[model samples]
Target chain A: MSDQVVSPRPGAQVQLEMAEQPEVLARIVGRRTELHELVRSRLPSRLRGISLIARGSSDNVAVHARYLLELATGLPVSLIAPSIITRYHHTPDSRDHLVVALSQSGKTPEIVDVARRLADGGGMVVAVTNDDDSPLAAAATVTLAVGTGRELAVPATKTVTGQLALVTLLAEAVGSSIAEYTGGESAWAALPDAAAQTLADERLLAEAVAVLQPRGTAIHLARGLTYCAALEGALKSKETSRRVHEGFSSADFLHGPLTVASDEVAVVAYGARGPVLADVAETARAAAELGSPVIGVGAPEVWNGVPGAIGLAVPQTLGEALAVIPLVIRGQQLAIATTLALGLDPDRPAGLNKVTATH
Target chain B: MSDQVVSPRPGAQVQLEMAEQPEVLARIVGRRTELHELVRSRLPSRLRGISLIARGSSDNVAVHARYLLELATGLPVSLIAPSIITRYHHTPDSRDHLVVALSQSGKTPEIVDVARRLADGGGMVVAVTNDDDSPLAAAATVTLAVGTGRELAVPATKTVTGQLALVTLLAEAVGSSIAEYTGGESAWAALPDAAAQTLADERLLAEAVAVLQPRGTAIHLARGLTYCAALEGALKSKETSRRVHEGFSSADFLHGPLTVASDEVAVVAYGARGPVLADVAETARAAAELGSPVIGVGAPEVWNGVPGAIGLAVPQTLGEALAVIPLVIRGQQLAIATTLALGLDPDRPAGLNKVTATH
Candidate 1:
C-alpha cells in the first residue's frame, strides 16, 4: 500500500489540477538556473527587503514564502496591507524594497493596483502568476509565470504549489547564506519527489476523509511554515465542503480558542518532527481528552501512544519548512475527498470565481 | 437608553476590566509626553523598522499596532513569528529594528523568550505590559506599564486598549509626517470623549446581542483598522460564549470565507464612513442575500438602506484607526452580553488561565 500509486477519478478539474503539483514542481526544479537568472535581472539592484501583497490561497503561499525567505536570507519580509494603497490611496516608503504580488489569475484588482503603486514608489515589483500577460505582470517590473497552465479550479491547488516552488527558487538564488541556514538548493531540488510521494498516498488521505467526513466543524492546527498549510486547508474545506473550518497556530489554540474544543468539533494537527512538535502534540492530546476526534499528520513519533487520534505520515524532508510542500498536498487531497464525500463539485464552489476582483 | 452608562454585574472581573477601558485610554492620552519620551529613549537610534511579537490577546493588540505604526509612521512593520525563535532557534537580523512585546501579565513564556532573543540580537526591546516588574519587563530595555492594575479577566480589555494607545503614542513620536495624514495629536486628545460616548450607549450593544445571541456560528467582518476589532471580537466570543465566531477582512471575506455564510451563521460587519466603506457594505449586502443575519457596527449610512442588517452607530473620530478605540468596546460589550445570555461566567472561562504559558 505504501508503494502503490492511486489516482483520483478523472474529469474533476480540481483533482486533475492538484495532481499536476508534482510534475510542475519538478519542472521548476529542472529550470532553476534559468528562473534564477530571470529573477536576478528583474530584482532591484539595491533591494534591502521584500514585501508581499496577496489574498486567499495566494496569500497562504506568501505566508509560507515569508518564513522561507527570512530563514534563508536573514532579511525582513512583510505582508503589506493592500488597502493602504487601493483603499486609502497611501503608499509606504517602498524604495529599495522588492514588492512581490502573487495571484493565480493576476486579475485581482487590488493586487494589480498594489503592484502598480509599488512600482511607482520605486520598489521593484514582481508578479508570480500562471498568466504571462496578466495585468499584474504589466504592473510589475518583472513577471515570473508559475507555469501551472490555466487552472480550472476555483480553489487554486496547482498554482499555489507552483508559486511556492518559485519562491523557494527565488530564496535560493537571492539569499546570501541560504546553504548555511537551510540546504535551500538541495531542498528545492528534492521537492518534486516529496510531492510525488505525497500524491502517491491517496489511500491515506481517503482514510483521513472517512474519519473526518462526518464532522460539521473542524479546527486545523499547525506551527510555523506548516501553519500556512492549516490556513489553506481550512479555506479549501470551508469553500468546497461548505462547512465551518477554522485554522489556528497550535500554540494559539491553547491560549483561548481551546474553549471551542468539544466532542462536536474535529481537530486536525500537522506535526513535523521539530522543536514545536511537543506543543502540537499537547494540543492534539488536549483536544482528544475533550472528546474531539483528532487527525495527526506527520511522523509517527508525534502521534504514537496518543489516545483517540488517527495518524498519517509526513513525507521525508531535509527541514521542517521544506516538509510543507508535501504536508499541503495532504491538505489539498483532504479538501477534494471531503468535497466528493459531500457530493459537491470541488472545481466550482458555489459563488466563487477564479479571480476574486476586490478593490 | 443612548446616554446611560450601564455596568455589568460587579462580581465578574472581566466585566469590571472591560469597564476600565475608557479611563485607561484617557490616562494614556493625558500622559502622552512622558510615554513618548520613554519610548524615544528605548527605541534604537537608527531604527530602520518595527517588529512585534505576542500571542493571544496581546497578539491582537500587536496586529492593531502594526496597522497604527505603518499608517502613522510610514515604516515597515512585521509581526515576528515566535516559533522561529522558540522552536526553530533562529533569529533574523534584528539590528536597527525596534522590537515590541505586548502582554497583560508580561509573563507569557514564548513572548518573553522572543524579547530576550531580540535584545540579545542587538535590537531594542520594549515591553508594554500591565506588570512593570515581570520577567518580560526585566528582559527588555524599557517597560511601559499599561496601568490597568491587575486585571482579573481572562480575556484582555483594558490592557488591550492601553497597549493600542501606547503604540499610537510611539507612532506619533517617531513618524516624520503624521500630521500630514492622521491628525494624530487631536485624535489622541479626542479618544477619551469618544470612548465615554461609546460606553454610554449600552442599549445599542444589548440590542445587537439580542439579535446575535440565537446564532450558533457567526462571521465578523471589517476592513483595515476595524478588522482587528473583528478578530478580537471573535476571540472574546469563542472564549466567553463558546460559540464559533470567525473574523475576516471584508475583501478577504469576499474571496473565500463568505462560503460559510448561511441563515444559521450570523454576520457582523464593522463599517466606517470612509474609503473602504463601500467594500464592507457590499460584503454585508452579499451575506444578507445569502440569508445570514447581518449586524452592522458603524455609521448609519453604511447599513441604513441595506437589507437584512441592524445598525449600531460608532463614536465619531478624526480617523479610522483612532475610531478603533471606540469600535472594539462594542465588540467587548457584545461578548459580555452574549456570555451572560449563555449563563456563563465571562471572567473565568473553563480551561483558560489569565496568562497562557506555552513553549
Candidate 2:
C-alpha cells in the first residue's frame, strides 16, 4: 500500500500569540496617558536609582528597561537578583530606590516576595503585570496593568512584546523621552502595524529560519538598546525549539566568546539602523569571517546587502528605539518556525509551563 | 600502517596558572587593609549606588560583586553595559555613584573609556587591575591593584581567583561583613589552602571529567552568590574547552531552562554549603532525574552525600562566602581537563589573545 501524505500541525496557540503581538502592543500603547499617570503618580519624590525585578520573558524586558531607564533618567539602573531577598533574606536598604517589578502572570512567588519586601523596605515598587489584582500588584505601591488579556503557549510571544512596549512607556513616564529617536507617540501607535508587516513577510521569515541549523551552537548578537531582542530571541528559540541559542552583546562577544564562532555555529545578528547598528554588522562580519553562518535580524533593508549576512529581516517602520518590538516579533516567528522544523509543538514545549513559580 | 602516535602536550601555561590560584588569592588577600583603605577613601560622602564595569572573566566577577554590594550597601548596584556609553554616548548622571571597574590588564579601551567618562561625570571610580599605572587607574579616583601579578595564560586562572578575592575585600571594605557567615578574617586567610586542596583531588577531578562526555551540551548550575561560579565556569569552559556550557541560577533554571536537560547533556552543579546550596542540590537532583549526569562543585562533603550527584569536590575550609574562591578553582581545573579532553591548547585557546582590544 502507498503511504498517505500528511502535514504537521503548526503550533496553533504560539502561532496565534505571535501574530497577536501587534494587537497586544497596540492595546497597551493605547493606554499611554493612563500608563504615564500611573507610573508618575507612584514615583517617589526623591528617587536615587531604579532596580528591575522580573524573570523569564519579563526579565528580557527588564534588560531593555535597564538601558532605557539609565539613558533617560541619567541614574543607575539594575536588574535585581530576587535570590538576594528570597534565599539570602537580605533586606537591602531599598529606601530611595524605585523598583520596577514585571510579571505577566503577576503571581510568580519570588517576584511577589521581592516586591513585597522592597516595598516594606521603603522602595517605590511599581508592578508591571497583566493581572492587576494578582499578588505582585497587591505587594507593590502601584500597578501598571499590562491589560493585554490572557497569553497562551509555553513560549510567550505577544506578552513578550507587550511587556517591551509597556516598559518603553514606563521609561517615558519616568522622564526618559527620546521622541527624536523613538519617533515619539506616533511610533508607539505605529508599532503594532510594523510588527504585523514584519510577520507578513513569510517568504523572508522562512529564509531566516532556514539559516538556523537544527541543533548546534547558535548566538544571537546585538548591541546598544536593541540587545534585548537578541536575548529574548535566544531564550524563545531555546524554549520552543529545544535548541540552545545564547544571546550576547556584539561587543561582549568580540571580547572573548568570539572563539566559539565557526561554520558549525549560526550567528543571528540583530542589526538595525541606529547608533550601534554598524557595531552589530561588524560583529556579524567577524563571525562570518570565522566561517559562522550569519542570520541578520531586523529590516530586510538593514541586512539585505550586508556582507556575508542572510537577511532574516523585519521592517523598522517605527523609529530606531522602537525597533525592539519588530525585532522581538521576528524572534518569536523564528522560534515557531524552528520548532515546527524540528517536529516539535511550540504551543507545548517540553518541560515548561506558562507561569514559572521559580521561588 | 604502523600504529604510532605522539602524546598530546598538556597546556603548560594554563595548567601552571591553575595550580597557582591559591598563591594569587593569598597575595591579594594579604593586601586586605590596603584594599579596604583604598576603597573606603574613595567612597563618596553621599553614595547613591554602585556600578561594576568589566568584561570577559572580570564581568563574571562583576556579577558576584553586584550581589555583594547590594547586600552590603543596601544601595542598588549595577553591571554597566559599556556600549550604552561607548555607542550611545549617554553620560548618565553618575554623581554619588561608586563605580568599581575590573580589568586584568587595565588597557581594555572600552573599560578605560567608560571609567574615564563615569569618573568625569562625577562618579567615584575604583580601578581594580594589575597595572596601577595603566589608563584605567589614571581614569579612576583610586585603584585597588589586583597585583596578583601578570597572568600569562589565555585562560586566566590566578587572575580570576585574584579578582574574586579583591572583590570580596572590596565588598568587606565597602561595608559587607559576613564574618558570621564567612567565618571572618581567618576564613579569608585559609581560602588559599582550600583552593589548593580542591586542586589536589585528582581522582575526583578525573571522575568529574569522565562524567562530562566529549563535545556535547553542558550546563553549570548554582544559586545565590555562588551562581557567579556557574557563569564564570561556563565562560572559562567555553573559552578553553570550546564545548558550549550554559550557566543558570538553580532558581532561574527551574523557571524554563529545565526543558533542555536530558541524558545527552552533562550538568555541572556548583553545590556548596550555604543559604541556597540546597536549592542547587534540588536543581542537580532534578536534572539527574531527567537523566543528566550531575557533577557537583565545592567541598566534597557539601555534595558527597547529596542525592543524584557526583562530587567534583573542593574543600571549604573557609566559610560559605569564601567558598567561591575554591569553587572557581574547581572550574579552572574542570576547564583545563575539558580542554585537554578536547585535544586543544588551554594555554593558548584558539583565537583568544591575553588582552582583547574590544571597543
Best-fitting candidate, measured by lDDT? 2
Give each model a TM-score. 0.93, 0.94
Per-residue lDDT of candidate 2, residues A1-359 (tens digit): 02211224558766766777777777887888987898898788888768999988788889998888887887878888998888777777778788999998898999999998889989999888878888998998888776765776677777778778888888888875767567787777778888888888776666666777455658898877789999998888888776668889888787778888777778888866778887788778777777778788785544555566777666656776789888887788788887787777877766667777678
- Residue-level lDDT for B144 in candidate 2: 78
Q: Model 2 Cα displacement at A310 (Å)? A: 1.7
lDDT of 1 by residue, B1-359 (tens): 23222336622677667777778888888888998787777677777878998888788878877877787667778988888777767788888788889888899998998899888988888888989989999998878788877777677888887887776676776665554334567777888888778777775666778777887778888887667878888888888887768888899888877777778788888866567778888888888887788888876665765685788776667477667667677778788888888787777666777778887
In order, the Cα lDDT scores of the candidates are: 0.78, 0.79
User: Model 1: DockQ against the native?
Assistant: 0.63
